[model samples]
Target: MGKIEIVEGDITREKVDVIVNAANSSLLGGGGVDGAIHRAAGPELLAECRDLRSSTLPDGLPPGDAIATGAYEIKKVKWIVHTVGPNRHAGQTDPQDLARCFSNSLHLARSLSARSIAIPAIGAGVYGWDHETVADLAIRAALAEQRERGGIDRIRFVLFSKDAAAIWSQAKLTHLGR
Candidate 1:
Protein backbone atom coordinates (compact mmCIF):
# COMPACT_ATOMS: atom_id res chain seq x y z
CA MET A 1 0.00 0.00 0.00
CA GLY A 2 1.05 3.57 -0.63
CA LYS A 3 1.98 5.79 2.28
CA ILE A 4 -0.64 8.29 3.34
CA GLU A 5 0.33 11.67 4.80
CA ILE A 6 -1.69 14.59 6.04
CA VAL A 7 -0.25 18.06 5.50
CA GLU A 8 -1.51 21.50 6.34
CA GLY A 9 -0.69 23.55 3.29
CA ASP A 10 -1.98 24.80 0.00
CA ILE A 11 -2.62 22.06 -2.51
CA THR A 12 -1.36 24.33 -5.27
CA ARG A 13 2.10 24.35 -3.70
CA GLU A 14 2.37 20.58 -3.51
CA LYS A 15 5.15 19.37 -5.78
CA VAL A 16 3.58 16.08 -6.68
CA ASP A 17 2.92 14.17 -9.85
CA VAL A 18 -0.70 15.18 -9.83
CA ILE A 19 -3.04 17.40 -7.82
CA VAL A 20 -6.63 16.34 -7.36
CA ASN A 21 -9.10 19.16 -7.75
CA ALA A 22 -12.38 18.93 -5.90
CA ALA A 23 -14.20 20.43 -8.77
CA ASN A 24 -17.84 21.08 -9.48
CA SER A 25 -19.71 19.65 -12.47
CA SER A 26 -18.77 22.65 -14.59
CA LEU A 27 -15.10 21.85 -14.21
CA LEU A 28 -14.35 25.28 -15.60
CA GLY A 29 -13.55 26.86 -12.19
CA GLY A 30 -15.16 27.79 -8.93
CA GLY A 31 -14.34 28.86 -5.37
CA GLY A 32 -12.03 27.09 -2.90
CA VAL A 33 -9.65 24.49 -4.25
CA ASP A 34 -10.96 24.72 -7.81
CA GLY A 35 -10.41 28.45 -8.03
CA ALA A 36 -6.99 28.26 -6.36
CA ILE A 37 -5.83 25.57 -8.76
CA HIS A 38 -7.00 27.48 -11.81
CA ARG A 39 -5.40 30.66 -10.54
CA ALA A 40 -2.07 29.01 -9.78
CA ALA A 41 -2.12 27.06 -13.05
CA GLY A 42 -2.87 30.20 -15.10
CA PRO A 43 -5.11 30.76 -18.10
CA GLU A 44 -3.72 27.78 -19.97
CA LEU A 45 -5.55 25.59 -17.52
CA LEU A 46 -8.79 27.38 -18.30
CA ALA A 47 -8.20 26.95 -22.02
CA GLU A 48 -7.72 23.27 -21.59
CA CYS A 49 -10.86 23.07 -19.50
CA ARG A 50 -12.75 24.87 -22.22
CA ASP A 51 -11.43 22.51 -24.84
CA LEU A 52 -12.41 19.57 -22.68
CA ARG A 53 -15.91 20.98 -22.34
CA SER A 54 -16.20 21.67 -26.06
CA SER A 55 -15.17 18.20 -27.05
CA THR A 56 -15.54 15.54 -24.35
CA LEU A 57 -17.36 16.90 -21.29
CA PRO A 58 -19.58 19.37 -23.09
CA ASP A 59 -22.46 19.02 -20.67
CA GLY A 60 -20.05 19.31 -17.75
CA LEU A 61 -18.68 16.43 -15.69
CA PRO A 62 -20.96 14.41 -13.45
CA PRO A 63 -20.71 13.68 -9.75
CA GLY A 64 -18.39 10.80 -8.78
CA ASP A 65 -16.68 10.97 -12.19
CA ALA A 66 -13.22 12.33 -12.98
CA ILE A 67 -11.17 13.61 -15.92
CA ALA A 68 -7.57 14.74 -16.39
CA THR A 69 -6.03 17.78 -18.03
CA GLY A 70 -2.62 19.35 -18.36
CA ALA A 71 -1.35 21.05 -15.21
CA TYR A 72 -0.15 24.12 -17.12
CA GLU A 73 1.61 26.61 -14.81
CA ILE A 74 1.59 24.47 -11.72
CA LYS A 75 5.21 23.48 -11.23
CA LYS A 76 6.28 19.83 -10.83
CA VAL A 77 2.80 18.63 -11.63
CA LYS A 78 2.18 16.71 -14.78
CA TRP A 79 -1.61 16.52 -14.68
CA ILE A 80 -4.56 17.90 -12.83
CA VAL A 81 -7.20 15.29 -12.13
CA HIS A 82 -10.55 16.96 -11.67
CA THR A 83 -13.42 15.16 -9.95
CA VAL A 84 -16.86 16.48 -9.08
CA GLY A 85 -17.96 15.88 -5.53
CA PRO A 86 -21.59 15.32 -4.74
CA ASN A 87 -23.32 18.18 -2.97
CA ARG A 88 -25.41 17.10 -0.01
CA HIS A 89 -27.89 19.94 -0.38
CA ALA A 90 -28.49 18.74 -3.91
CA GLY A 91 -29.78 15.47 -2.41
CA GLN A 92 -26.52 13.61 -2.95
CA THR A 93 -26.48 12.05 0.49
CA ASP A 94 -25.00 8.71 -0.46
CA PRO A 95 -21.50 8.22 0.96
CA GLN A 96 -20.53 6.04 -1.99
CA ASP A 97 -20.60 9.03 -4.27
CA LEU A 98 -18.13 10.75 -1.96
CA ALA A 99 -15.99 7.64 -1.94
CA ARG A 100 -15.96 7.60 -5.73
CA CYS A 101 -14.41 11.07 -5.75
CA PHE A 102 -11.26 9.62 -4.17
CA SER A 103 -11.33 6.25 -5.91
CA ASN A 104 -11.91 7.65 -9.36
CA SER A 105 -9.26 10.35 -8.98
CA LEU A 106 -6.72 7.86 -7.69
CA HIS A 107 -7.58 5.49 -10.52
CA LEU A 108 -6.94 8.22 -13.06
CA ALA A 109 -3.70 9.18 -11.32
CA ARG A 110 -2.55 5.57 -11.39
CA SER A 111 -3.42 5.35 -15.06
CA LEU A 112 -1.12 8.33 -15.62
CA SER A 113 1.59 6.48 -13.69
CA ALA A 114 1.60 9.21 -11.07
CA ARG A 115 3.75 8.20 -8.14
CA SER A 116 2.56 10.98 -5.85
CA ILE A 117 -0.73 12.81 -5.61
CA ALA A 118 -2.00 15.60 -3.36
CA ILE A 119 -5.73 15.74 -2.69
CA PRO A 120 -7.83 18.19 -0.72
CA ALA A 121 -10.81 17.65 1.53
CA ILE A 122 -13.09 17.05 -1.41
CA GLY A 123 -16.74 17.07 -0.22
CA ALA A 124 -16.01 18.93 3.00
CA GLY A 125 -15.85 22.28 1.26
CA VAL A 126 -18.76 23.97 -0.45
CA TYR A 127 -20.40 20.58 -0.92
CA GLY A 128 -21.31 20.63 2.79
CA TRP A 129 -20.15 17.15 3.76
CA ASP A 130 -18.89 17.08 7.33
CA HIS A 131 -15.13 16.85 7.90
CA GLU A 132 -15.31 13.56 9.79
CA THR A 133 -17.39 11.88 7.11
CA VAL A 134 -15.21 13.27 4.35
CA ALA A 135 -12.04 12.16 6.06
CA ASP A 136 -13.34 8.65 6.71
CA LEU A 137 -14.51 8.15 3.16
CA ALA A 138 -11.44 9.73 1.60
CA ILE A 139 -9.02 7.62 3.59
CA ARG A 140 -10.98 4.42 3.02
CA ALA A 141 -11.20 4.93 -0.73
CA ALA A 142 -7.55 5.93 -1.08
CA LEU A 143 -6.33 2.97 0.97
CA ALA A 144 -8.50 0.61 -1.04
CA GLU A 145 -7.20 1.99 -4.31
CA GLN A 146 -3.60 1.81 -3.14
CA ARG A 147 -4.07 -1.85 -2.28
CA GLU A 148 -5.98 -2.70 -5.45
CA ARG A 149 -4.15 -0.52 -7.97
CA GLY A 150 -0.64 -0.14 -6.44
CA GLY A 151 0.90 2.42 -8.82
CA ILE A 152 0.76 5.49 -6.64
CA ASP A 153 3.61 5.70 -4.14
CA ARG A 154 2.32 8.50 -1.98
CA ILE A 155 -1.10 9.92 -1.13
CA ARG A 156 -1.06 13.30 0.60
CA PHE A 157 -4.18 14.88 1.96
CA VAL A 158 -3.39 18.62 1.85
CA LEU A 159 -5.61 20.82 3.90
CA PHE A 160 -5.77 24.62 4.06
CA SER A 161 -5.91 24.83 7.85
CA LYS A 162 -4.49 23.19 10.95
CA ASP A 163 -7.94 22.12 12.11
CA ALA A 164 -8.61 20.36 8.85
CA ALA A 165 -5.22 18.72 9.03
CA ALA A 166 -5.91 17.58 12.58
CA ILE A 167 -9.23 16.13 11.54
CA TRP A 168 -7.67 14.20 8.68
CA SER A 169 -4.87 13.04 10.96
CA GLN A 170 -7.36 11.71 13.46
CA ALA A 171 -9.34 10.06 10.69
CA LYS A 172 -6.19 8.46 9.37
CA LEU A 173 -5.38 7.07 12.77
CA THR A 174 -8.92 5.84 13.23
CA HIS A 175 -9.26 4.20 9.83
CA LEU A 176 -5.66 3.20 9.12
CA GLY A 177 -4.76 2.44 12.75
CA ARG A 178 -1.56 4.41 12.60
Candidate 2:
Protein backbone atom coordinates (compact mmCIF):
# COMPACT_ATOMS: atom_id res chain seq x y z
CA MET A 1 0.00 0.00 0.00
CA GLY A 2 1.09 3.54 -0.66
CA LYS A 3 0.67 6.45 1.80
CA ILE A 4 -1.15 9.77 1.98
CA GLU A 5 0.98 12.73 0.97
CA ILE A 6 0.21 16.45 1.40
CA VAL A 7 2.72 18.02 -0.92
CA GLU A 8 3.27 21.56 -2.13
CA GLY A 9 3.68 21.24 -5.89
CA ASP A 10 2.09 21.40 -9.29
CA ILE A 11 -0.41 18.75 -10.28
CA THR A 12 1.10 18.65 -13.75
CA ARG A 13 4.48 17.87 -12.23
CA GLU A 14 3.31 14.95 -10.14
CA LYS A 15 3.92 11.46 -11.45
CA VAL A 16 1.10 9.33 -10.18
CA ASP A 17 -1.33 6.66 -11.33
CA VAL A 18 -4.11 9.26 -11.72
CA ILE A 19 -4.77 12.93 -10.98
CA VAL A 20 -8.21 14.22 -10.12
CA ASN A 21 -9.33 17.39 -11.84
CA ALA A 22 -11.61 19.71 -9.84
CA ALA A 23 -13.89 20.42 -12.76
CA ASN A 24 -17.27 21.94 -13.47
CA SER A 25 -20.37 19.91 -13.97
CA SER A 26 -20.25 20.51 -17.69
CA LEU A 27 -16.88 18.74 -17.85
CA LEU A 28 -15.79 21.15 -20.55
CA GLY A 29 -12.45 22.88 -20.56
CA GLY A 30 -12.68 26.18 -18.71
CA GLY A 31 -10.78 28.23 -16.15
CA GLY A 32 -8.89 26.86 -13.13
CA VAL A 33 -7.86 23.21 -12.98
CA ASP A 34 -9.86 22.33 -16.07
CA GLY A 35 -8.00 24.90 -18.11
CA ALA A 36 -4.64 23.96 -16.60
CA ILE A 37 -5.12 20.26 -17.30
CA HIS A 38 -6.29 20.98 -20.82
CA ARG A 39 -3.40 23.33 -21.46
CA ALA A 40 -0.90 20.71 -20.26
CA ALA A 41 -2.63 17.74 -21.87
CA GLY A 42 -3.05 19.56 -25.20
CA PRO A 43 -6.00 19.95 -27.60
CA GLU A 44 -6.59 16.23 -27.76
CA LEU A 45 -7.84 16.35 -24.22
CA LEU A 46 -10.40 18.95 -25.23
CA ALA A 47 -11.34 16.86 -28.21
CA GLU A 48 -12.14 13.97 -25.92
CA CYS A 49 -14.02 16.21 -23.49
CA ARG A 50 -16.13 17.69 -26.28
CA ASP A 51 -18.17 14.52 -26.58
CA LEU A 52 -18.95 14.56 -22.91
CA ARG A 53 -20.07 18.15 -23.12
CA SER A 54 -22.20 17.65 -26.22
CA SER A 55 -23.86 14.44 -25.27
CA THR A 56 -26.56 14.43 -22.64
CA LEU A 57 -25.46 13.20 -19.27
CA PRO A 58 -28.30 10.79 -18.60
CA ASP A 59 -27.30 10.55 -14.98
CA GLY A 60 -25.97 14.09 -14.97
CA LEU A 61 -22.43 15.07 -14.01
CA PRO A 62 -23.50 16.15 -10.53
CA PRO A 63 -21.12 17.81 -8.13
CA GLY A 64 -18.78 15.28 -6.48
CA ASP A 65 -19.38 12.95 -9.39
CA ALA A 66 -16.32 11.97 -11.43
CA ILE A 67 -15.59 10.68 -14.93
CA ALA A 68 -12.40 9.28 -16.43
CA THR A 69 -10.29 10.04 -19.48
CA GLY A 70 -7.03 8.99 -21.03
CA ALA A 71 -3.87 10.66 -19.84
CA TYR A 72 -1.72 12.87 -22.03
CA GLU A 73 1.88 14.15 -21.70
CA ILE A 74 1.64 14.16 -17.91
CA LYS A 75 3.77 11.13 -17.18
CA LYS A 76 3.24 8.08 -14.94
CA VAL A 77 -0.52 8.40 -14.86
CA LYS A 78 -2.60 6.44 -17.32
CA TRP A 79 -5.89 8.23 -16.55
CA ILE A 80 -7.39 11.46 -15.24
CA VAL A 81 -10.56 11.63 -13.20
CA HIS A 82 -12.70 14.73 -13.60
CA THR A 83 -14.75 15.38 -10.45
CA VAL A 84 -17.17 18.27 -10.13
CA GLY A 85 -16.70 20.56 -7.13
CA PRO A 86 -19.21 22.65 -5.21
CA ASN A 87 -19.26 26.38 -5.62
CA ARG A 88 -19.20 28.84 -2.73
CA HIS A 89 -22.30 28.85 -0.61
CA ALA A 90 -23.39 29.74 2.90
CA GLY A 91 -25.01 26.39 3.45
CA GLN A 92 -23.92 23.00 4.70
CA THR A 93 -24.75 21.51 1.30
CA ASP A 94 -21.55 22.86 -0.13
CA PRO A 95 -19.36 21.01 2.33
CA GLN A 96 -21.39 17.86 1.89
CA ASP A 97 -20.92 18.04 -1.84
CA LEU A 98 -17.22 18.73 -1.51
CA ALA A 99 -16.84 15.66 0.66
CA ARG A 100 -18.68 13.61 -1.94
CA CYS A 101 -16.16 14.73 -4.54
CA PHE A 102 -13.38 13.07 -2.57
CA SER A 103 -15.48 9.98 -2.06
CA ASN A 104 -16.26 9.68 -5.74
CA SER A 105 -12.68 10.21 -6.83
CA LEU A 106 -11.43 7.66 -4.33
CA HIS A 107 -13.97 5.15 -5.55
CA LEU A 108 -13.00 5.70 -9.16
CA ALA A 109 -9.28 5.45 -8.41
CA ARG A 110 -9.79 2.24 -6.51
CA SER A 111 -11.91 0.80 -9.28
CA LEU A 112 -9.12 1.61 -11.71
CA SER A 113 -6.64 -0.18 -9.43
CA ALA A 114 -4.71 3.02 -8.97
CA ARG A 115 -2.44 3.00 -5.94
CA SER A 116 -1.15 6.54 -6.31
CA ILE A 117 -3.40 9.52 -6.98
CA ALA A 118 -3.16 13.29 -6.62
CA ILE A 119 -5.89 15.86 -6.05
CA PRO A 120 -6.08 19.60 -5.84
CA ALA A 121 -7.72 21.57 -3.01
CA ILE A 122 -11.27 21.33 -4.28
CA GLY A 123 -13.50 24.41 -3.86
CA ALA A 124 -10.74 26.50 -2.33
CA GLY A 125 -9.89 28.60 -5.36
CA VAL A 126 -12.49 30.11 -7.65
CA TYR A 127 -15.13 28.36 -5.63
CA GLY A 128 -14.44 30.82 -2.83
CA TRP A 129 -13.99 28.36 0.02
CA ASP A 130 -11.83 29.01 3.07
CA HIS A 131 -8.57 27.11 2.62
CA GLU A 132 -8.17 25.76 6.13
CA THR A 133 -11.75 24.57 6.53
CA VAL A 134 -11.86 22.84 3.17
CA ALA A 135 -8.49 21.29 3.84
CA ASP A 136 -9.76 19.79 7.09
CA LEU A 137 -12.86 18.37 5.46
CA ALA A 138 -10.99 17.03 2.45
CA ILE A 139 -8.17 15.51 4.47
CA ARG A 140 -10.52 13.91 6.94
CA ALA A 141 -12.73 12.49 4.24
CA ALA A 142 -9.74 11.09 2.36
CA LEU A 143 -8.27 9.51 5.48
CA ALA A 144 -11.58 7.95 6.48
CA GLU A 145 -12.10 6.54 3.01
CA GLN A 146 -8.56 5.21 2.96
CA ARG A 147 -9.15 3.39 6.20
CA GLU A 148 -12.20 1.69 4.74
CA ARG A 149 -11.24 0.60 1.20
CA GLY A 150 -7.47 0.40 1.55
CA GLY A 151 -7.28 0.94 -2.21
CA ILE A 152 -5.56 4.28 -2.64
CA ASP A 153 -2.27 4.00 -0.84
CA ARG A 154 -1.00 7.35 -2.06
CA ILE A 155 -3.47 10.22 -1.93
CA ARG A 156 -1.98 13.66 -2.35
CA PHE A 157 -3.34 17.16 -1.93
CA VAL A 158 -1.38 19.18 -4.49
CA LEU A 159 -1.67 22.86 -3.67
CA PHE A 160 -0.99 25.55 -6.25
CA SER A 161 0.22 28.21 -3.89
CA LYS A 162 2.42 28.32 -0.82
CA ASP A 163 -0.47 29.71 1.21
CA ALA A 164 -2.68 26.85 0.22
CA ALA A 165 0.13 24.40 0.90
CA ALA A 166 0.73 25.87 4.32
CA ILE A 167 -2.93 25.57 5.16
CA TRP A 168 -2.94 21.95 4.14
CA SER A 169 0.26 21.34 6.08
CA GLN A 170 -1.27 22.76 9.23
CA ALA A 171 -4.50 20.88 8.73
CA LYS A 172 -2.67 17.63 8.20
CA LEU A 173 -0.69 18.21 11.35
CA THR A 174 -3.66 19.22 13.48
CA HIS A 175 -6.04 16.59 12.15
CA LEU A 176 -4.25 13.74 10.40
CA GLY A 177 -1.21 13.80 12.70
CA ARG A 178 1.04 14.57 9.76
- For residues 3-106, write the lDDT of model 1, one tens digit per residue: 99999998999999999999988888999999999999999999989899999988999999999999999978999999999999889999999899999999
* Each prediction's whole-model lDDT (CA): 0.92, 0.80
What are the per-residue Cα lDDT tens digits for candidate 2 across 1-178? 3466788887877898899888877776778777888788877777777777777564447887888888777767788999877877644355888888888888888899888899998888777788887898888877776787566888899988888888888887887554
What candidate 2 gets wrong by more than 4 Å, as runs, is 56-60, 89-93
Lowest summed lDDT across 10 adjacent residues in model 1 is found at: 142-151
